[model samples]
Target: MSGSGNVHLRQMARQDVAAGMELVQAAGWNQTEADWNRFLDANSEGCFVAEAESTVCGTAATIIYGHQLAWIGMVLVHPDMRGRGIGTRLLRSAVEYLESRGPLVIKLDATPQGRPVYQRLGFEPEYEIERWKLTATPSLHSAPGAIPLDDDKPDIEDVIALDAEAFGASRSALLHSVHRDAPEFTAAISAEGRLLGYTFGRHGLHADHLGPWVAEDQEIARRLLETFLDRSTGRCLIVDCVKAHPFAATLLGSAGFEFSRPLTRMVRRAVQSGRRSGLVCAILGPEFG
Candidate 1:
């Protein structure tokens, strides 16, 4: 019911799914209609989409976590609408709605272009990071001392609990979502049965993306990552590592992992209490913000 020069911002409706997803791909975020629909369907509280002249112009979603935190999502702008303030308006609406509801502010990872806009809106840079992915052989065989987390029903909940403690965020749903029926992903533990580390990922159409690779230490982290590559064999194995972490540069560099993409985990004031580098893989996902 809103329009501005053919541009309108409002909550996304059930009918908006297909067109909204088409717009998502056109915005160059590398997501699909199915992905967009699933995201919106899961988000009952809401999603924000902007339409221009009855066509999809932009879309973003907010997934509220326990009424105390909300994660921003899929902020896309039409290719033709670049620099027209469509995205800014969509993002602003999301933040404003969240702030008014009082959810300790919000957080999101931004692409280079998205970074500047968020910065202008008071979002702060979180330790200069990049989402690095590589698909070689699975690291399972090559990484020394690498043992699968699920070998004997490895306590997924325990690993998730450790992750929540390290990242200082409520991620049970996230852990459940990523680990459910996804075998390409993996978790690593020490010989002494200590909760060492893990990598969450899935096989996508183009490539397999492993994110949120967290660990107890550099050695364990290296083993977990190396295991992924070794297990991949002829297949492509992917991982997203944070530059801010202590051994990310060294380990990835040693493994010949190149920086193919750059993204930022942008944050605004009334900040949520969590350390992205402490026990993070890739800030969960850039698209999830």
Candidate 2:
């Protein structure tokens, strides 16, 4: 356990899921109880919670991708606890934990309010990301070559490989978790029997979130996105898109997706290699990426 003054930090447990959900809901975040569970299930020892006077007041979670990369997310502080140093402490705890594990890179998608705190922790801006939303069904034509991949299908491995190439790290575990939760939202595009792109989605509290959307080019990205949108007709959808990607803005705009907010993709320490930024149209989510 770690603490400063009245604020105490400890490893988040399964029992703390409800408390975590309360913080998420209070922040108007899209995460559900299941999302909280996913973090604990992924890395029980790496997730942390803060307490003040014995009440949980803040939380932070981390997911390490085989020492290549680690993600810090779900950092939250209760409204009443905002002015204290709880958030910083929680972030520090997460960073320290991830650093101990020897990942080459640590990353987080920072809200404007959290950017400065992250900057102070030695995180440098990587790129701008935007959350785009579609409230109504998009008028999308069928993506003829795109095919759906069920969680149990043999093709799922191909999807994982394609994703690893684009994301620069292997996130097969998270991808499997997403597929387990929303298999209907998983799709891929292939040409000449080779995987070109893949996309995954998860059910959010208020919308269907599509992402980690990767492709070889704009046309492939569009096809994957169109497949997702076509399947998610009449439902609210969200995509956290990389601003620098060539196809994101145009595709999202044409599909009637309006920009919601900006998130900065920040990285701690230097990025060595293998990040195919051009291939990644949207990330899984700010919390997961």
RMSD of 1: 3.4
Model 1 lDDT per residue over 24-76, tens place: 55654445454555566566446888877777778878765655666677888
lDDT (tens digit, per residue) of candidate 2 on 227-261: 78767745688999999887788899998899999
Top candidate, metric lDDT: 2
C-alpha lDDT of all candidate models, in order = 0.67, 0.85
TM-score for each candidate, following the candidate numbering = 0.84, 0.92
lDDT for model 2, please: 0.85
> Which residue ranges in model 1 land beyond 4 Å of their true spot?
1-4, 32-38, 135-146, 190-193, 230-238, 274-276
Worst 10 residues of 2 by lDDT: 145-154
